[model samples]
Target: MLDWTTVLVIVLMAASTYATRVVGFVVLRDRTLSPRMQAIMQNVPGCVLISVIAPAFVSSRPADLLGLAVTLAAAMRLSLLPTVVIGVVATGLLRHFVG
Candidate 1:
């Protein structure tokens, strides 16, 4: 049922993502990054994660907000896997009960 345009777009997107990573490795292969650059690179993933998730929070329903709050609380006290599990369970429960 997928259209040709959608398939082509998906293929191009995959290629572009692959090319980006390959280009990064090729361009940086012989160079040593500075400490400041390294620190910035280390934080990119977290910053990207926040940027992607922040919009969801702003537009979330009550159940989603409650789940996110529980997730945040769990994140403070637990590690990554537990926090994710807690978030998913809490969200599913809240959606079932509240929605």
Candidate 2:
């Protein structure tokens, strides 16, 4: 049902993902990273998380924005459980009253 270009693109993506996972082990098997590389690696997860969430924040409703603000603040000051609970409760309440 899929065209060749779509299939090729999907295959390429899968192969690239697989290569990234395997290449780290192959390339770094015997050596350690430099300090700069280590710092860059440490930041990768946060950068990726922001990349995934940035688009949603741009497109969200006002109520959702309020919820996200509470969530971000809670996340920075509190812990995961409280952050998630605050996000959910804040969004629900805002949606009920303002939405």
What residue runs in model 1 are displaced by over 4 Å at the alpha carbon? 1-12, 74-98
Q: Give the TM-score of each candidate.
A: 0.61, 0.51
Strongest candidate by lDDT = 1
In terms of TM-score, how similar is model 1 to the real structure?
Answer: 0.61
Report the lDDT tens digits of candidate 2 across residue range 1-99.
779999999999999989997998798889889999899977776575556446649855888788778778887997556766787788789889878
Collision count for each candidate, in order: 0, 0
